[model samples]
Target: MTDTVLEIKNLEASYGSVQALRGVSLSIQEGTIATILGANGAGKTTILKCISGIVDPRKGSIHYLGRAIGGKRADLIVRMGIAHVPEGRQVFPLLSVRENLWLGAYTRTSRVEALEDLEAVYRYFPILKDREKQEAGKLSGGQQQMLAIGRAMMARPSVLLMDEPSLGLSPKLTEEIFTIIRRINRDWGTTILLVEQNASIALQTASHGYVLESGRIVMEGPCEKLFQDEGVQEFYLGQKEETGVERRRWKKTRKWA
Candidate 1:
């Protein structure tokens, strides 16, 4: 049986007085991709932050490989093999692409492994290699996203938490990013927890899914079932399931039918 790589119980977090996560709990199995679906301010990003130690949970337990990790330092989490590709592709604008990638390996003690990982990242995103010397700000949006993922990969993480990776990209670029995401998971046996607003793509990409609303988990199931859920179809998937009357009306109005 595949082991649970990360687990959370009753996770809660907030900003000032505003609660962002309310008893949020989930688990990701080894070598699988799990996605959280929600709208903006639904606390999707906050969950990722809590996992990667960017935001400390107010009340909860976060476990990685059966060890508690909540409230740890962010850099310590990275060193513990959890790398976060945050929302908005926060690459250092003034730094060279190579420089930004190297920063991901700051916790590693071995220079040789870091070099090898850099080459591996280059292989994953050859565009980054081509733009190695270029300032990160000079690259296009898609390239910058690639750079962000590559930087995270430099940490050689066991679990990768990706937040809105498809955000701000064209359809083609989004597809490209997800393709690489799948490849990373497949090739490296990486357990991934993806947080996304694009429900359609997120459903397609992940094996298991959770739906968050108002800082709480509203639903969860296998991706296939979640994709077919009426609420999910209507709200998240942008699909309106027609009632019998509506279907009849639609059929009646279709001259070609």
Candidate 2:
């Protein structure tokens, strides 16, 4: 039997009057990577924020490791073994690389264990090791992304929530990051819930996928199945060879649900 490590059911959230998530529900199995694919403003980031307790859900339940964690504080959620690597690589620019990574272990009780985790992060990102004393802002965009991910790992989380890890990155850098993400899941046994606009890479890296549109889950299935789907091929993967007219016609007739 597949063990579900995280589950979000009928989740609803909003920013003031603007509703961001409308009953979004999904589950991630233990020790696997799950990807959420969507366009901008589709509430993909909102889901991760809700899970990480950065945004409070107005309704629904969030379960991690069979425990209810809805409405918990963000720091409390992190201490409960979930770490969120937020969008836009929000590393503290003024802090040194080592200092930024050390902050991820704020919830940890043992200093020795935190130090060991820091070494593990360095192993995954050797560039970070070389720049340990340098200010985080001095690094390039890709290096900052590496630091963001490494800092998350320093938390020693069982479940990692990553939002738009490929945003603003070159293709080569994006590939490298995804490769490291796969390695993190495979080698460290950490379950990941990844939100990405790069649908092709997300589908390829994850074992299962969910498609979100306008604050709701529109479709979901195994990654291979989603990759081969005609609509997904056209809308997400750019695999459709049809002319513009045919594309419009298909959209007019297609039912997203």
Q: Name the candidate that leads on TM-score.
A: 2
Mind sharing the TM-score for model 1?
0.94
* Candidate 1 ranges with C-alpha deviation above 4 Å: 246-257
In angstroms, give how far residue 8 of model 2 lies from its true place.
0.8
Candidate 2 wrong stretches, greater than 4 Å: 242-253
lDDT for 237 (candidate 1): 85
Please name the candidate that would achieve the greatest lDDT relative to the true structure.
2
Tell me how far the alpha carbon of residue 102 in candidate 2 is from the true structure, in angstroms, after superposition. Answer: 0.2
**Model 2 poorest ten-residue lDDT run:** 245-254
Point out the worst 10-residue segment of candidate 1 by lDDT.
248-257
